[model samples]
Target: MNDPRSPAQDPDSGSGLADWTAGAADWIARADRIAAISRPATEILLARLDPQPGQRILDVASGAGDPAFSIAERVGSAGSVLATDGVAEMVTALEGRARERGLTNVQAQVVSAESLAFTPGRFDGASCRFGAMFFDDAARTFGAMATAVRSGGRLAALVWSCDDRNPYFTVVTAALDAVGADPVEVARTVFELDDPEEVLAACRGGGWVDARVEAVGFPWRLPDTRPETLIDTQSELSRKLRKRMEGLSADQIERARGIVAERVGQLEAAIQDGDDLIMPAECLALSGRAP
Candidate 1:
């Protein structure tokens, strides 16, 4: 649900983001909620990157430009970021956001990681958040990124850890299973690459060396959000449930909503901050250096 290719660099744009094309609206709508929940990981990502002024950075899978525009702010006017994704709709949303923020140094486009057009050693460093797990081929995806970065520049990101430690993902998912809908297949789950060894192998296969993996986790915060707002942002649940209830009545939607609310309430009752909720989560903060 993230990242973009540069519109100005249409020559490099590809159609690899079909998976997210129709989901663009959902991604944009959920961006803010996602940000609040993911801040814990993003904080660690930025710390490890320590992006410098005047550095050319690449923000891959920069959906709604999470750390991309945020990085653009840190790099200031001297540095720029090429935020890219395979979905044009997602890039369009990012473009709107950049304009709203008056970010002249940031650019969004429909670029695929499989077809990066930059020259070797083109960037000072790169960043990707949760986007790595969705790639069709993780190794080749990172390899392309490595080929584009300068030596000494590192790529850092936050990836979901195992499901057991990240209950925010599993709690709601388990609820759906209890409701008789099959959960997303484990192979297709976002935490598929939770294993550090798998990540290390991907880094090495991608021409990135000196890799490091660090634990970074936090609660799924409800900052400026609530159960209803949070519910709409649940991608896995919304998507699967929508298909499961395709021909049902409005009553069915309402019933499903009630079930989710009850399930979520029970899971968070112990940790609820009045109306605010905090769900436990686990993630890995990783870095890979260009050779």
Candidate 2:
């Protein structure tokens, strides 16, 4: 997937390592929120992968180890899982989780999808959950992923579909607009590389065979959400949006928060006990076999 914007113009252009590392580290602290956003989708991905014992699997951009650790459980002691991220912090968090779960078959490492430091044809299968979309050189990343897996091995990834297809993100967009923040830039970053053609192009570029795309949808609920957490999450979104929507005012930020809070309130009421907020999300699950 070639970038419409040149590397010189993109944060991922020359060196996205530092920024990506820091971002993942900071975000790892919000493990619960991360899980809320991705767990259901991850479950669907694992079910699709249908990992078997005695097979080796690699999880690229394993973020906090949700997909990686889950894979480990399925493979059991006979199978092994290498869960890697480009950020050390993410690997650390993943390691911690693996320890907690006594998952000896799972190991975490710091590695990138574009330049994985593994021997060729070492893995039986590889998977990435909402990870490959951030690559500066997506084609190179896919090629490397292809090289890592043995012939006939599987390549699977879970990525967000277009913005309109996802209400969780649309709600965020609405809040940002209410706050008078320019959201085009952040929105672009969020969905720019998510097009189906680009994804298939990358996979084909990497020499993957039988590439197929699946659409998965499920309800994601945030239970026990605190007002403070809601405000904080909105603020975080506002900050990210600020990178694209310049000149965001405090008043606008407050307004955005109020609107999002109201939406959450309605969702909470729908929970029957005013304890949770649920929204629907759609994702693309792309898979292929390495040649």
Candidate 3:
């Protein structure tokens, strides 16, 4: 789930919208890769939301639509999920993903979490993953999500815990920074929303009752991945860094890729789960109920 806030409206040049819009196809291609990492968090969020069959749900900032698709399976034929994101390109990709699976119960819409066009109290529950942190106005955007939930409905979100605990981003980011990347852009993502206190505050500000934040460790495994494959995945996954690195000569890019792979590969080898390369990661799962 995401803030639904469009990057074009974001004041910061590093807001991630331009690159995301320009390279949505890459994000779609790597959607399964992201799903591999986020699957665990989605389960945690689903448990928090507790959606039953016949319930109506919302997933904000549903980039590429994993948690949404997973939720659709949980809700089954009787239930429905409205997946949304302000990025039209993301929304389009989500639609295709849903169609590919023949998931008629889930629909993708281009909308912002800061301003929902849905009817009041229309949703039984709502969930977001890896989206809340990028919101232009988190309080208002999260609040808008809560507003869409019916009375006594639940809201759950997944966010990064701390950069130190997430080598998937930290190691590569550190390596990239060493090569003259913009610290502001590199530091802006997972690190920005790493604080649980901020997550709690956003829930409270969003007008949710009995809000709480908890830290959870997630295992990310890239199965049978080669160094080159890992580097390509990292390049596409790191939106900002990939955008900046595009201007580099092919040799420079390859060298930078090697540096990142070397750093991230160390993480890949740290813990191998079966033949898969496992990268240890952690996140904060925040949940609350609309009053």
Which candidate wins on TM-score?
3
lDDT of candidate model 3 versus the reference? 0.77
What are the models' TM-scores?
Answer: 0.82, 0.80, 0.84
Off by over 4 Å in 3: 1-19, 179-188, 226-232, 244-269
Q: For candidate 3, lDDT tens digit of each residue in 1-291?
A: 333434443333555444345556677878987887677788888889888998889998898998999989888999999998867878888988899999999987877655565677989998998888867677787788888899999998988888778877666566656666554343136556788888899889989999999998877776775544555566667666677666667776667678866776666434655666677788898899998
Give the alpha carbon lDDT tens digit for every residue of 117-225 in model 1: 5788999998888888867777887888888899989888777889877766665555445556544322245786899888778877888888888766677776543
Give the Å shift of residue 111 in candidate 3.
0.7
- Residue 248 of model 3, lDDT score: 61
Report the Cα lDDT for candidate 1: 0.72
Worst 10 residues of 1 by lDDT: 7-16
> How accurate locally, in lDDT, is each candidate?
0.72, 0.71, 0.77
lDDT at 189, model 3: 60
